[model samples]
Target: MVEPGPSISILAGGVTALFAVFLTFYLRNQWQEIQSLRAIQTELEQNNERVRELAQLLTGDLQRQQIDLPIEVPPGTKLEIRYVVSFPSSLSTTAFDQLKHSGMFLRLSPETRRSLFELYDTIDRINRLRQHRERIHFDDIGNVHVVIDPSELDVEPDASVSEDDLSAETRRRLSDLREMRRAMKGVNRSILRLIASIASPEMIDDLELEPFLGTAHGREAGHESNTESPRSDEVDLEEMRSILRDVERESVWSRFM
Candidate 1:
């Protein structure tokens, strides 16, 4: 019979080789997981940036809407309401898809996962609303060039055409815009909270999102201060006229076309 010592040595060597192979594969998998996590973190930061930009854009639009409250078509003016749709960043989902497909997204705490889903869902809703709004504005109505001859200007706009008329598609668009703005604010807060929870301290500092998340009351105070000084009807009307004049001078449609 072969010596027991030789047989034991061969078995030990085989075991060692098998262990090495397993270890190598294990380490490689761990490294890949780490890389995936880093990618997810980076993507989250980018999504947050996009969300912030959307928020700022929506805020500006809402402010303009406020300034144009009680929208009116001036007499002898051709009111051209062009649809200028802004798309959200396309980078929002590629990394997220990778993370999900890697099966590592499941490793995140349930709460974090929920927050991420909520944020994405809100973004999807915003996108859908934008698409619908664009369709309604551009396709359904065709060009929104409303020619108000001087005669029509003096005449009160048709009750159906009034800004307050909920039946009016323009009113619906404004309503949807306002809703989207509010949703974007909530999304911003969610993104900030998620970043605060998941981001490394260094990463957080690099992102420079602390100011936006931390200055809630200050922002509110600033908004109040800016809007609290009530303007006269004359001023408001003048502002609306200015906007209309600008719209006329720079046809939004021409730029897009």
Candidate 2:
């Protein structure tokens, strides 16, 4: 067997050292990336929890109150309308803001970055809705009631509630609240999915919301696909639908002092 030359031995040692250095740096970088993901996951989890709480508050408290449009207040009863909204701006965005400002967010894959942006964007949208809701103002349609009574509820609604009454500006505020509530629910669901994706080894594409497409809303939204038959349980979403007095009669009550 031929003996190796000194020059060959030196070259082999140099290559081995270089490979070791590269592997060390590669592993360190991977560890750091995991740490960063954990930090972001923590912030997103908090955002999800808080938004879920807000959704619940709206769903529960709104059940106790009712403000159907063309709001007719009988003599001596008061109409009290209150919107309990939790603004997202108040929540801490430290981790997310840091990620964005440091350009770390840009480093993520297209699907991941898009999901993260969507999560934060939903929060921002709810905040904007809350702000816009407060600005909603309208001229009084008729007598304004400060409080409501069961006897007041018993009075027959004026059959002639006009289209203009249904379109009153005051109702816009309530509608905005409804939007915020819906967004709050959806955001948490997205966040949960995002969190799950983070822990998952496989990368995910964007999630598409497939709302029930068997109602008038389906046609209005321009969805060409329609169901041939309704499901045993059905739900619908319509912002402009004129279903008057949708307040839960069994779950509603009002008080005044």
Candidate 3:
């Protein structure tokens, strides 16, 4: 009728109680992590749009540039600018860094865990993108001054702009910028979804966690916080170029991968 199982040797005196205590501690830690993730989700939600807007602003700037770099330009006595892409300084991974480094990452559902990794990986990619753009801007600047005559306005440099227009490198940089914007949209979108799922976890492990989390408040279901879709879905060039303008301000500079 019933299946027989292997016999159990009794755990030593404090061993059973120790395990119970540890289980309680682990649940408490998980609750704390839920809070931390919500914080990250909030920060990501706020910044994602800003980052996306910034990237759009950048592509416009690049197109408007008489010299988008990744090309040689006559260093005419003209305007010089250094564009820096910026986001709110509020976002930080310190909490995530700690939890991930600990046993906590193993506590999440496989899907949730994977999503977390994806969110942060994109962040690293964006940082690299920023650095790459900066390198492209600064590295060739010194060389441009060294080789070209100062009389031309780059437009007037030999009395004209390049007949070829944007060089291959410049085109590649614009592509990179759009890709970066898509990535930023992803971070925002994914984090929102994740936090929603966490708020109302369906995994068996999460269900079992309820008694421990009974006192903890959970967020209402947030299936679709953002009504607008990710900008990645669009591939329209005419629309993209409409906003094209000068890159003299700090608002533009483009993407990574």
Best by lDDT: 1
Q: Which stretches of candidate 3 lie over 4 Å from their true place?
A: 1-31, 68-92, 102-104, 139-257
The models' CA-based lDDT, in order, is 0.47, 0.41, 0.39
Better of 1 and 2 by lDDT: 1
- Candidate 2's residue-wise lDDT over 206-247, tens digit each? 222122222333333343222122222211111101111121
Q: Tell me which residue pairs clash in candidate 3.
A: 176-255, 177-255
The digit string of per-residue lDDT tens for model 1 on 1-257 reads 79999999999999999999999887666555555655655665665566455545444444444413555544334454433546466435665567666545676657555655654554445444445434544454433333323343334444323454233554666555455444444333433333333333444466554543332445443543221121111111122223323433353332322
Best by TM-score: 1
Arranged by TM-score with the best first, the candidates are 1, 2, 3
The per-prediction tally of clashing pairs is: 0, 6, 2
Better of 1 and 3 by lDDT: 1
lDDT of 3 by residue, 93-157 (tens): 55557657654456555755555555555444444444444455445332221122235322544
Q: If both were scored by lDDT, which would come out higher, candidate 2 or candidate 3?
A: 2
